[model samples]
Target: MLADVQKALDAFGEREINRVFFVGCGGSSSIMYASKYVMDRESTSLASDLYSSNEFIHRNPRQLGPESLVILCSHYGKTPETVEAASFAREKGALTVSLTFDPDAPLAKASEYVIIYEDGKQGGTFANEAPAIMLELVLGLLSSKEGNTKLDELLPSLENLRGIIDGEKAKSLAAAKAFAEAYQDDKVIYTMGSGANYGIAYWFSICLLMEMQWIHSHALHAGEYFHGPFEILDEQVPVIQLVGLDETRPLEERSLEFTQRYGKRIIVIDAKEFDLEGVAPSLRGYLAPLVMQAVLRQYAEELATARNHPLTTRRYMWKVAY
Candidate 1:
């Protein structure tokens, strides 16, 4: 399952490159952000660029050159918008790398490099998203010589998470089941995350919509909870918090309190359940989100199934046509 991804990492590690531009849409776009965040926290090996496929095709005007390598993220090479970006990247003379399940996928055919994730065949939304997360970790590890930086340090734990979540009867099912029931009636899903977990917020919403659910969900930066989003909270509304162990615990705690102030409950999913006051301040933030992401992913799926809905109503993320 991981064979192509492993090869992609080895290939990426050997590159003597300059600028790195990461381009993907929807779940695939998270890969670009994850890569940027991981590298920014540790080193300056390469200057990185992150762009959504639509933006890259319609709005972004940056130059793509031989000196720059574009990490093109798409689970299905058939996604027209991303495939267009893939074509554009090629025409611009930039080296392209892709992470996908099929080695011969149109997206893979469009890149100079390709990585495949064989976890399971059809996750729909989950399919492309998981590979992006997995490859980002692997690429982060291969980037350094010490191989002991924060990114490398967390790779094993992240890998373990992918394994656990891959199973149908994983331990996270129970928690996921419970959480889903709590918000079954919610009109919107507010996924909150801090520090590295920012990507998680997006990851969760993507899964809920793709895992055969029709929920309208959006991501919130953890500390940014103070924004007007707090304006629409009440007993009928719930704000699910992705509380991880990280340097930003104090900030997360403050947000937790703020959510409760709106008369809403704060559900913190971490390595283990604990009283909010007793959780660690400086925590192991890396792997905590993976476990919960898996748990909540299932909950999101169950909620949609109970309501008789398919992952998302739209054929794709066509948010607008005007």
Candidate 2:
């Protein structure tokens, strides 16, 4: 999967892409989400721009013209929603691309182009790690190409990031820190963010809810926090803010200060500059989330296990009304 992602990345070199839409169900959508986070300002993405196939007939009807390229992602080719989306796009004359672990699934046959992700493993539940890493690789390639970064030069740092993420000891340390902050006496977790980090906030809620601690969680925009979310803040319900070096730094800083002003506590993840309190500065953009994934994964798994839950499950998700 990693090498394939690298190949897709290597193949992307600002190849005159005007518009691309990414469609998927559940975590498969992360490809588009991560892509949008790393997307160049010069280009536009419809990646996170998802729509339910059943609803399309009434709301937000897709006008798929011949010139559009639609990227379809599904870990399992059987996801009815995604497959229907692909079929709809294809019938409307859009190009389709699919990335899936199962090469023989319906999605593989449905897509015009397919990238197989068989990591020498048999059937198992799809975790958050592999899909995120795989999508990141391809989008990183596409992004680097668009940003005009020498691919060879960026490869080393990207490799370094991969190494740190893959290393158990480093992941352990980061996870320990995140657990202390995430599961500290508070049962309520408030996720707030701005800019690209907003997606991280969204992803955090997903992991925390679905995989990790099954605690009550809510996510909101950092600026909007002052309007209403701030009222709910207290020591027992501390705010977990995503602060990265994106365009939202100044506002995040103000948000950090605002949290402290009300005696509302916070644990900053991926923010810049610490002159103020709760400003956890991480690397810029996608790199920040990559760097923080270790801790996030750790806290999520540990909390889930501590509550006697398995890290992966299939019982509930298979209720597909096919």
Candidate 3:
């Protein structure tokens, strides 16, 4: 899948492409947030933007044109708004690419370049695959433009990511079990993280807890917590902090310290605690969210089991027309 995406990217030529837009919905949109972060920090020549499907179609950016590349992601590829957004981009003469689990999905039909993955193969999480592919795509494009060998050197390490994630399954399962057991009775949960892991935090809060398990949850950035969210901290409220081994670790640490002092039920899922064997040290910061996604899948499953709620149970997601 990575090679295929790289090939599609190569066909565009570095100079021909002016901007890259990562557009999606829900968890898909959250992963694009991380992709935009990577492009902003690493890419020198290419510009990157992120937009939700509905917003992209209604409030389209003026920069979108024939020279622009729009990357649309949807696991099922059937999301009405995202499909409409892809059509809108195509109408504007922009190149459209889609990443989805189903190659024959509506999203794939709307795209010129499609990258498909087996549904259950990516550690039971769609969040893990898209970012890995998108990150490599951005890095590869930037490396070609800047002659940066570091990105080329780091690209191959992503192939070993699955093995690294599998090696930590036992540890992730244990942590999930403990977290589920402890937070089973909590009425509402608070999740926090910084940097790339912020997207994972948002995914857990919106996708897993609220949407799947029907539990009330809120996701907040560690840096933003002190501004307003910190006022909600108390001894009874449970907090889940995802700490990554990145430059933003200090921000999460500050939030952890303050949460620990006030909240009695603070659960920390720190990537520093895991042994991400075979992954390069220099790339750990970028891969931290992928690692957390693997761990959080286990946590989500365990939480569903502990609460006697199946993850498949939904009230309005697929049952009714929205």
Candidate 4:
């Protein structure tokens, strides 16, 4: 995967790249948020943005050109909008790189460079997962172009991620099961997080709770809670608050305190629960989302079982064309 990222970087060349755009849909789009966050915080000159694939096409930014790099993602490589966006980027003279689980997937074929990744089912290493690969790609760009030194700590943590994830999953099982039993009957659920872990909250709300389990769900940013979303808080709406060990921890902590005061049912999945023995202290923030996602997958599974609904069950996703 690193080799493929390097190939993309090489193709991009030393053209004084000024901007990056992350384009995708659904879960694919959610994973890009962390990469964008990393770029925003670390890079002084490079600008980064995230767009849904169709939006990327319709609102095509004028900055996209030979000096730009666009990264597109689709798990199966068949998402029409993302594939079209990749082609559109290439046509606009921006260097295009795509990530997918299939090398022969349409998204792969459409882009100039491709990086193949492993989903949870493949199970060899967390580094092969979409988030890790995307982080590496972004970190690679920052390291080479901006002289960012984060990768030194990040690479070692990624190497140990699979073990950390597995351990968290094992330890989180009982809490997940309890959450499922208590919240299975609720009509609506909410997820909230801040910083890098926000994407994990979004994925859980959209893909896992709502899409798979047929529950009404929404993802909330912890920082934005008091502004308006906190009004919706009550005993009935179960908010699954995801706490990351990042610099933004204070935001989540503040929201959690309010939720505890006003909300009756809350499930707090704090990344601090994981030991993270081998991961460096400085990189824990970036790794928190990945670890939380792995732990939350167990919760999602337990919720599905408690509701007597399989995670694979879907109503209109692939079955109906919009």
Query: For each candidate, what is the lDDT?
Result: 0.60, 0.56, 0.82, 0.89
> On residues 103-209, what C-alpha lDDT tens digit does candidate 2 reach at each position?
78888788766677643245232222344444454445446535534333334444454444445335355545556655645567777777666656766776555
Question: Which residue runs does candidate 1 get wrong by more than 4 Å?
Answer: 1-3, 6-14, 61-63, 121-159, 162-172, 206-212, 272-284, 310-322
Question: How would the candidate models be sorted by TM-score, starting from the highest?
Answer: 4, 3, 1, 2
Per-residue lDDT of 210-245 in model 3, one digit per residue for the tens? 998888998999999999999998899899998998
lDDT ranking, best first: 4, 3, 1, 2
Between candidates 1 and 2, which one is better according to TM-score? 1
Listing every candidate in turn, what is its Cα RMSD in Å to the true structure after a full C-alpha superposition? 5.2, 5.9, 2.3, 1.2
Which pairs clash inside model 2? Answer: 243-270, 243-271, 271-280, 271-281
Q: What overall lDDT, based on C-alpha atoms, would model 4 receive against the true structure?
A: 0.89
What TM-score would each prediction reach against the true structure?
0.77, 0.73, 0.93, 0.97
Top model number, TM-score: 4
Lowest lDDT 10-residue stretch of candidate 4: 8-17
Pull out the clashing pairs in model 4: none
Worst 10 residues of 1 by lDDT: 274-283
Q: Judged by lDDT against the true structure, how good is candidate 2? A: 0.56
